[model samples]
Target: MNKIKLTITGCLGRMGQQLIKSAKNSKNFKLVSLTENRIVNKKIFGLKPQLNSISAFKNANVIIDFTIPKCTLEVLKIASKLKKKVVIGTTGFSKKEENLIKKYSKNIPILKAGNMSLGINLLMYLTEIASKSLGDNFLSKVFEIHHKHKKDHPSGTALMLGKGIATGKNKDFYNLMGKKYLNKKTFPYSKKINFNSIRKGEIVG
Candidate 1:
């Protein structure tokens, strides 16, 4: 039996760098390719792995993307064509991009996540509890603290907190990050939910 081959996109980002490092350390995974915005040094993963030349995924069985939505869509298309399993960790997808993922999921085993943090996902569950029991009369507020360098401002964990609360209340439209907050107000918003973002130095979520 051969080890499973893996490819990573946005291999230059912080998380991408971490995944590559982990994969290099894992015995069951063989890194087949790396994708980046521009052609850079080839010594990624400290092994000089081959670069992924085909957007259609010619070199690996699985593809992981931690890039922007536009690049995600392109990678999704390529993964669909190659019929490779894809794990997407990119956050802040537009409505259209979300739908596109669903559209292609029928053909590929695509794992999509907002924050992809186990602790934060657990926190989402707790936020559900708060949303369910807390009432408008209680005047509850939700908050998030993240490193200033976080790619997704407000963090996907914060979005999940608001989502958990909405599910608890059994109603939507209760977010502090405006629907178009990223494009406009540049933050989450809720009259009561109050989604907040913290940007600071060396703070890890």
Candidate 2:
């Protein structure tokens, strides 16, 4: 009957703030530490945010990251060294960086996902089933919309859907991945998985 000590990275970012609020309300976790890429002098929820370091994460049972790829790798490095479990919700990692994350997992337990929403996961599941049921005649494309401030095109959720389609087809995700279109009104569905991302004002779709 122990609470998990949690650390959230990029504590000033959107998801980081959301995680802090959610963790504050959760009974199963204690928010032990918060971290950012740079020095943060101000305190959030009675805890000062620190830069990613061994000292920052040495005491945490689990670390949740919602930052960019570089910062996530930094967290992984520290977490791997400290032997801490990590949950990654960051996106926009290149295939090479993705491989490096897998390498980091060899030493420490890590659970990484582009999107962690139940609805999104369910959508991915349904996409997989549909892909399998449709067979070769039907081509597939993933389209998504997000807030304008979000920089990564095709969004992580869109990519997740792409992976689901690949899984259903029994193809490698990287090999099956096709074009990524941003702010486009139209796109084509090829033999592989294609993606279209629409960025608008303040819509979390």
Candidate 3:
């Protein structure tokens, strides 16, 4: 049987590295390319990393991206032209950027998510149900904690929960968005959903 051609972007990052190990161990995928924003001097798993471009992704059947919003968009643009499928696991995108991704999806198949954990997705689904069941009298807020090294203010999972709240309310997530606070001891609940994120030593909850 032929293996699925796979290109992994942000090859040096934590998620990228994890995907590399997982993909290498799996029989379904053949890691054809690895990409980063800058040039990589060393070879990883026998393939040198390249910058995101049409040429870099031209030969792949699918591209899995675990990069920032900027880099993800760059990869999407090239992948759209190449007509390749993409799986996006990156986070921290504004409403406009999210819209841009939807636009690209019109041209090529794309699967995007803030978190891939089954438990988290189930939690998100539950949140949507609760939000929808609750009346307007109830207020909503989100809190999350991540590794100290994580840079995004509100983790992708937090945004996903907020989106759940919006989905329940039958309102736009951006329109319902409230202030985003990082490492704050306290935050207020408003007409819109608020998000508070705490970053410290790795906590998996």
Instruction: Report the number of the highest-TM-score candidate.
Output: 3
* Top candidate, metric lDDT: 3
lDDT of candidate 3 over 1-205, digit per residue (tens): 9999999999999889999999999999999999999989999999999999888999899999989999999999899888999999989988899999999999999999999999999999999999999956789899899988787878899999998989988988988899999899999988888889999887763
Across residues 93-163, which tens digit of lDDT does each residue of candidate 1 receive? 76567788999999999998777878878888987887678755444445566666676665666667767
For candidate 2, lDDT tens digit of each residue in 73-140?
Answer: 98998888899999998888988999999999999999988788889899999989988887767888
lDDT of 3 at 82: 86
Model 1 CA lDDT for position 174: 36
> In model 3, which residue pairs have backbone atoms overlapping below 3 Å?
none
* TM-score for all models, in order of appearance: 0.81, 0.95, 0.97
lDDT for each candidate structure: 0.73, 0.90, 0.92
Off by over 4 Å in 1: 45-56, 135-140, 173-192
lDDT of 2 at 62: 97
Weakest 10 consecutive residues of candidate 3 by summed lDDT? 196-205
Which has the better lDDT: candidate 1, or candidate 2? Answer: 2
Candidate rank order under TM-score: 3, 2, 1
Off by over 4 Å in 3: none
